[model samples]
Target: MVKLATVPVSQVAGIGAQKVKELESFGIRSVLDLLEYFPFRYEDYRLRELSEVKDGEKVTVAGTIYSEAVYQRYGKKSRTSCRVMIDSTLVTAVWFNRPYLKDKLTPGIEIQLTGKWDMKRLQVTVSESEFPGNGGPAQSGTVQPVYSVGGTLTQKWMRKSITQALKQFGEIIEEVIPEFIMKSNHFMPRKEAIRIIHTPADTAEGKQARRRLVYEELFLFQLKLQAFRTLNRSRADGLVHGYDNEELRAFIQSLPFELTEAQKKVIAEIIRDLRQPYCMNRLLQGDVGAGKTIVAAVALFAAVKSGYQGALMVPTEILAEQHSRSLQKLFEPFGVQVGLLTGSVTAARRRDTLASLQMGLIDIIIGTHALIQEDVYYRNLGLVVTDEQHRFGVNQRSILRRKGMNPDVLTMTATPIPRTLAISAFGDMDVSTIRELPKGRKPIETYWVKHDKLERVLTFIRKEVSQGRQAYVICPLIEESDKLEYQNTLDVHAQMQHAFPDLKVGLLHGRMPSGEKDETMRLFSTGETHLLVSTTVIEVGVDVPNATLMVIYDAERFGLSQLHQLRGRVGRGAHQSYCILMADPKSEVGKERMKVMTETNDGFEIARRDLELRGPGDFFGTKQSGIPDFRLADLSVDFEVLEQARDDTAELVAQEDFWTAAPYVALRHYLQREQIFQGELMD
Candidate 1:
């Protein structure tokens, strides 16, 4: 019992060789592991007398076994039935599936069973039963923690093992929260919290235990984010560019379309960041078609006017080429050179571009990941703009920023997420949002078309294409999979080709070779392909303003935020755009998501709904490797706590010697034990 922390769990009292492996597979290798494995939920059961139990109620009743359990067969089904006597009242208990429980229901055995009261039949359906003579601590109270159990691991066995571990090693787990806070908040110590959480006397203790755990989870997360912030600022001295408005004004004036107030405001913010000594680590978030590219161009032009080169890093060659052409158009009037570098560039052309970049002939260079290649070097790089996919490709942007001497970085995301979630994901970076659509931009007409109305939807697409506009037919899958029952792009391509033989139909999916995909997209972008049958690969950076009609097949299979991104592909042109969702949602949540898609064009609203339904882990892409996986705290429900912890972290960091505090040391120790230590101090 005293050696629980450092000792291996295989050596624990009751564990055998076979059980050790099974427990280890559950990530429980040592006493420390077992102790930290908190329950996912709790079940309530209390001792109750038969007289006190009412009909249609569930209660724990103690009784004496009146008869041996017997397995009785009726026609094709068999059930195990037994009788228990509580005082003078007799009740029959039946288990439909668990015929193996006959051995445990022997006559003359004393029992306390948790079951539902069925007064009309005078029967109690035994849900869970445990014997007191089991070779482990009798872990019981009004509420019992239910762990996440898996193969060959019964809840009773796990409860017994965990109960034994708690009794043995409870003292080994230290209390990190200060004694004063624990007392004032009426929270038990970490040791006692672990004990009460696994076996709580009442719901209050369970709630208190969870509160303490949530506080620590959020506290550590804030500490880690703040630590990252400190490390980033101290990485290197930032390149400071002069504040110049004439060049930016010229570029803005040359634009044929007028800029919205949101665009103007974000551009000014970028200008201010460029003028500062510290490197700009900023996230630019604008709804689909809100003029983010224009802001990026304006910022890059500002960097160039300050007598330094800028680079724009996009995720794809198609998007990079589009940005290159757009930048050239923006900079040509002022005689600023914009060069393109992509894998598809001819070798000789790449050499020429590299030489030009080295000789400072190119004021701005735009490309895909090729921008970070060793051979390409900037003459005087001062700014790096990234067309991020909103998954926080932090490392991609970092590599591009490292191409310069701590160049100011601006990352642009078309996907609009909730403001609190944005803060959680990008706590180390400043954020500027553009929520307003540009002048003369009309909202896309969104509609939900059921399965039987597919013909009508196709007619609408045909009508739109007949008006000289293009269309995108998006399927949720690339190829048909036996596992998934949704339509795929390849089949849809064939269907479209047969249905509308007169119109040009092109196929594009992620499985296609990169060059082929690019060619297909090029054909679509240039209007040679009137209708492009594709998958969600076009959801990110593909832009075809002429494509005004979007028909999503199996629309219910995709998430709300993703559907919003798909809708963004259209509505870029002056013509009115239409997005028709082809769906047959059976579940209430799926139906609600489809309804939300039709209700609003606001990306943020869709993201908020997605957050509420799917949670933060999936909302953001997978967690970056360095980011901690919060075990107890959730960004959605714990937003207020996250804010408080963030404020507390700021105040704590401001102290002259905060790390020296005892409570701080204890907290830091816990973080170290979890392997995400608050970062080391700068040299």
Candidate 2:
């Protein structure tokens, strides 16, 4: 039998070349793809008797035309209305801009109308029309699947083509899940589930079919993730670092601030990973300003104390330099050397840093993408730490790890990930989270204000600046855009300078050169520039202690996570910082975002709300964030199913014969064919 996935849609009985072109636009290419193209929603076209029909119900009613159609033309549009007799009662049927309905609804003609019945008007606003004997679903018990399509493909044609495809290839649709698991879950057979999903007898059956498919998607994803984890753990060449060094203990004791309980717990997890025989593939995540850097510092110290080099890679040069300075300060007393490598570093300095790194003189090296260059070599790279892990791609991380022999990897991020997304996106790695901020930290007071209050906000900023403090003014765009009505950074910079002529104002955006951005940030950090106006470029690890105010213009345009991150920029210092959200949002979602921001400073709670409002795709840019775009599975609502799938797959993969078992042969073959399994497991 020909495989459904191998057969092109063009080979289907009725889909011609033109139809194939149209289907390709919807991302449907193969017979399997055509069969799996599920509907976004369904319509109940089930025929109802006149006595059973209720007012305000979207239903289908068939009747015979009792009167001549009345047509009225208003400007470029026309209206057609007629009376139809259902049993003994008469009901009015109406259509807009449909002059052809007048001739179609002649006297004594039987017609079917599917639309809403208005109670007060005693009329059926017809959206679709059909004749009794035209072989349409005019009798009763008909459900229509509403697909997302366009460009020469009508719903009727799409339904017909899918029906034809199923008739030809439904039996050959192989079941990938094992039969024992199917019996345990009482799942519908794969073939029958596909059939019922497209043309179910009722809503209940459609729901059952959907549950089965959703479970399959999440289970397969979890299985692949577990397989990757198992493969990584099989290697025994990982370095086992020592964490009980006297200098490390002394350094921890000498810190100015105490570690939060959450930070201590996460540091313990990382220390445990470092002592294992296998490489550590761990993700350390926390809310912004949750003391993740201190925990990371401990882990890096352990690696260095074990007589091995450590590499810390970040997204931007500013963050790298910041980490370099702080770590140097923390480790200088302990005689641990720290090196900085960035794009803007002079060639001579970079050469010297590279030589020091190669000769093991640098105990810890911090850099941006420049760290991964060809010339940079490590003597004994034991632990690899990448901050803002989402900023770097999987290949870039793999390359950095490959610089040493099976070194342990630790990736850190300040963005709080919702529990469901963490499971689906980072399921292959061990996760450690820090949720509490250090003591003496003040919560940023947030307020949502209208645009008309801009002058008052400026006055507030002026007062704060006059008190010898600094402020940050953020905008959504870099320059003026006719397309988007957002306040731009350049314009905001000029306005701030004019608003407070005595205060030095600086401008920064992504479009600026690296050196200029660094300079602007330096001036702000040193209190030379009292007001720094910029875009979301300062959203991440740019920390200034004296900055006490963050004013966001057009705050409604940003997502909850982004708004939270921007707000986190301030409140890092001991001052009572304030985040003033300045915009009047028009949409309900925009208003809800502002409300959520003002209600809580907890990043995890905000993340949950963000996931609910924007979904997983837009939460972190699904394509770039390594989140799987499952067709039927929604991370927000299907988290329970996702948990079940993760557990089941993890248990199954732990079995000794999981890969070679007879019942899993088809699954193994599919995984291998999809490249979900590595070369060692290809047998």
Candidate 3:
């Protein structure tokens, strides 16, 4: 493998200062980075003829210009037009805002045109038009890779940079995967794959390279994740919280509603972990409407029954308070004392709660990250339950784990993570999934509406409010931005207040003070507010069963899974709930995303589709969401590889002398380097 430091822009002979800067913008500063910067797309222009060119199809054609160019100027704008005859067929080419193109394209001059053709206009608006002698169709036709570029970095410059970098480093690009794995998978050789990917001689070559590369990326990522899991399971201090039959039976009988088969299965798994001699690091993943909270309650009860205290940590104060209230309701019958601790809690209340917790006066403590505070000491803390676990980092969970004598951890998330992602991101933990929703609950009615239909939507919301039903209006941003035209939480709140003066509209966003957020959430949940205008802060754990409408502004800005989660906030009660996705109809991506939300209520399906459509980066965003930043692996495409990698890593680690293996040494070093880099980044 080429060392990252040895690869520099100057090594690419043709790279100048400006070109180097452009490459740097795409995070390509070294030869290794350049080689690893895979193509976002490829233009397979191997076959094309004017006669065979389908309308609206992107194709490449080489021909001589047979007619004089025409130029027209309308006000400040100018248009250039020309006709090219190829294979006994004539196609018009038009260029907007480039009148100089008319002079450049003289009649009888051989040129190559590549662009989407519009049959209705008989035009091929060339994305790229070049003279036949200067790198014409033949040169461009060879596997043309396309990089995602900003407006400042033109396609020509990107192509030139890649070409130069490949010329210098192509021969030196190293293959890391073992030869056996490559051969078993029927993958092309690394050097040939790189060459074909960048400059494929034909469409088939490009496809083959893409297939191999995508698989490789996924396979490596899975291997790394599996390795991490194997190492963790081996080293973690296992403390079995011996089971108490009396407490388990009492906890189950105390519930008002019967446990669903899925919930029962998950509870059994948790109990099994608690009884085992090994440390219980378990991930309880469930859909939004699924009864994960109740299962957690039962687990907490079980811990308390075994004479151990449990702490439940939530991401938001609203969720903390909600958990405290719900748990109080459930545990009250069993004489369990539940205390709430949040940043907003009064000093006196916090001091009293801390005193009670230390004295074993409080059996179950429900709080935010405040539960992890150094000043807070648990009397006999044994179980640490983290709700919406993705919102917390590994270190945060670890801190909680250290509070007791190797406490058992039960992390939970309403976001239904795919098996591959769950294994990689939470591979250290045993996983249990709650796949079923409650019996009486009905699926929400979802809709995708154009922004122009907002007036009607508002009218519908007013009608719902008149019927004593509440609604939630969610925005992507907290405040109105000069950069984007989409409505924000503050803007929407103000607009709603102005439009409906009698309606109680409240705004809640991440920027608000913790106390204020709690108050706003409380009002919305208790029917004090008819409408709650908020950002995605209410995406998880804010349950308002009375609310019946969920209107999302700029719905396209959110992933399908996230939108589904937001939709889950409503539709909790008996009345039918509606999710109105207000999006820009002009954007194809936006429309498609909203369509997914409208078509499906299955969180798993939405998550799978979201991963496939946006990839992991866009789905999680820059905040990382507690998932490690993967350089090469794509969770969507590499799921199968991840499973295989996990199995292999587990088996290898189970070997008598696995740690001393040569490949293991290198892998360990790589992981250590990645951890250090990640720590620096997080800092």
| TM-score for all models, in order of appearance | 0.85, 0.93, 0.81
Local distance difference test, candidate 3: 0.79
**RMSD, one per candidate, in order:** 4.3, 2.8, 5.0
User: What range of 10 consecutive residues in model 3 has the weakest lDDT sum?
Assistant: 674-683
- Which lDDT tens digits does candidate 2 get at residues 1-683? 67788899998898898889889888999999999999877888878886687888888887899999999999999989999887677989999999976777888978888888986777899888888786755424588777888878988888888899889999999887777678888999999999999998877888899999999999999988888788767767678887665876787887878888898788778888899898888889899999888888898999998989999999888788888988899898888999999998998998899999999999999998898988889999999999988788777787888899878888898878988999999998888988778888999999999999998999899899989999999999988899998899888888888899988999989888888988899999999999999889898888899999999999999999889999999998888999999989999999999999999999999999999999888777445787878989999999998998998889888887887878887777766876865523110
Number of the top-ranking candidate, with TM-score as the measure:
2
RMSD of 1: 4.3
Off by over 4 Å in 2: 8-11, 17-29, 48-58, 74-77, 85-91, 117-120, 134-140, 676-683
lDDT of 1 by residue, 490-596 (tens): 89999999989998999988678767887898899899999999888788767788999999999999888889989999998899999999999999889999999
Candidate structures ordered by lDDT, highest first: 2, 1, 3
lDDT tens digits, residues 479-532, model 3? 768998888888899989987899899999998988888789889888999999
Worst 10 residues of 1 by lDDT: 674-683
Q: Which one wins on lDDT?
A: 2
Clashes of 3: 2
**Deviation of model 3 at 146, angstroms:** 3.0
In order, the Cα lDDT scores of the candidates are 0.80, 0.87, 0.79
